[model samples]
Target: MTKADLVENVYFRTGFSKKESAEIVETVFELIKQTLEAGDKIKIAGFGNFIVKQKATRRGRNPQTGEEIEISSRKILTFKPSQVLKNAINEGAN
Candidate 1:
């Protein structure tokens, strides 16, 4: 779902005003972004871990032109879900 949906869900579950819920969600997102930008990991129990990984430069091809290119190194974000989250998803399928 989108951020608006998340804010609405938070408002309903926490009995908070829509504005407050939005602020809370925005703040959480900002914090996560800042943490990752600072090269740190964030682990939320029962959810997952957010990690930043550095990738080295690699050779790549331009699909359209069939030309070879060098892909620059970059930092990427990754998520590893907790077992609890995996179990919940599996349970819903049954």
Candidate 2:
């Protein structure tokens, strides 16, 4: 779902005005962004974890030219869903 959908969900669930719900949703997203920027992980029970991982520089081959290229090191964010969430999703799929 898009951000607007989240805002609408918040508005309905919390009895807040649309503007307030939007602000609340935006604030939550901003906080998550800041946390990830700081290289911190976020863990939500029964949901998943947001983790930042570091990768070292490596060599890779360009598919088209068949030339060797250096891959720069970088930090990446990854998510691992909790077992409870996995089970819930599987249950729904069945």
Candidate 3:
């Protein structure tokens, strides 16, 4: 779901006004962004961990032109779900 959908869920569940819910959602997202940008990880219990990983420069090919190129190093964000979440998902598949 999109952010708007999440805001709506929070509004209904927390009995917060739409504006307040929106603010809360936005603030949470902003905080996550700030933390990741600062090279920190966020771990939410029963959910998952957000990690920032640095990738080294590598060689790649331009798909269209078949020309070789150097891919610059960069930082990427990744998520690893908690065991609780993994178990819950697996249970649902049964």
Candidate 4:
């Protein structure tokens, strides 16, 4: 769901005011963003882990021009779902 949807969900679930729900969602998102920016990982039980990984510079070819270029190093965010989450998703499919 989108951020607005999240806020709405929170509002309905918690009986919080719409403005308060929005703030809660925004605060949670801001906290997550700040943690990622600090190169730290976030792990939630029965959910998933948010990890930041570093990728070194590499050579890559331009798809259209066929020109080789250097791809700069960067920090990437990745998520690994917990086993519980995986099982829940699989069960839903069945």
Give the best candidate by TM-score: 2
lDDT of 2: 0.98
Give the clashing residue pairs of candidate 1, or none.
none
Cα distance off (Å), candidate 4, residue 61: 1.0
Q: Write the per-residue lDDT of candidate 3 for residues 1-94, one digit (tens) a residue.
A: 9999999999999999999999999999999999999999999999999999999999999999999999999999999999999999999999
Per-prediction CA RMSD (Å): 1.1, 0.5, 1.1, 0.8
Please write out the lDDT profile of model 4 over residues 1-94, one tens digit for every residue.
8999999999999999999999999999999999999999999999999999999999999999999999999999999999999999999999
Residues 1-94, candidate 1, lDDT per residue (tens digit)?
A: 9999999999999999999999999999999999999999999999999999999999999999999999999999999999999999999999
lDDT of the candidates, in the order given:
0.98, 0.98, 0.99, 0.98
Q: For model 2, how does the per-residue alpha-carbon lDDT over 12-81 read when each residue is reduced to its tens digit? A: 9999999999999999999999999999999999999999999999999999999999999999999999
TM-score of each: 0.92, 0.98, 0.92, 0.95
List clashing residue pairs in candidate 2.
none
**Residue 48 displacement in candidate 3 (angstroms):** 0.8
Better of 1 and 2 by TM-score: 2
Error of 3 at 15 (Å): 1.1
Evaluated at residue 31, the lDDT of candidate 3 is 100
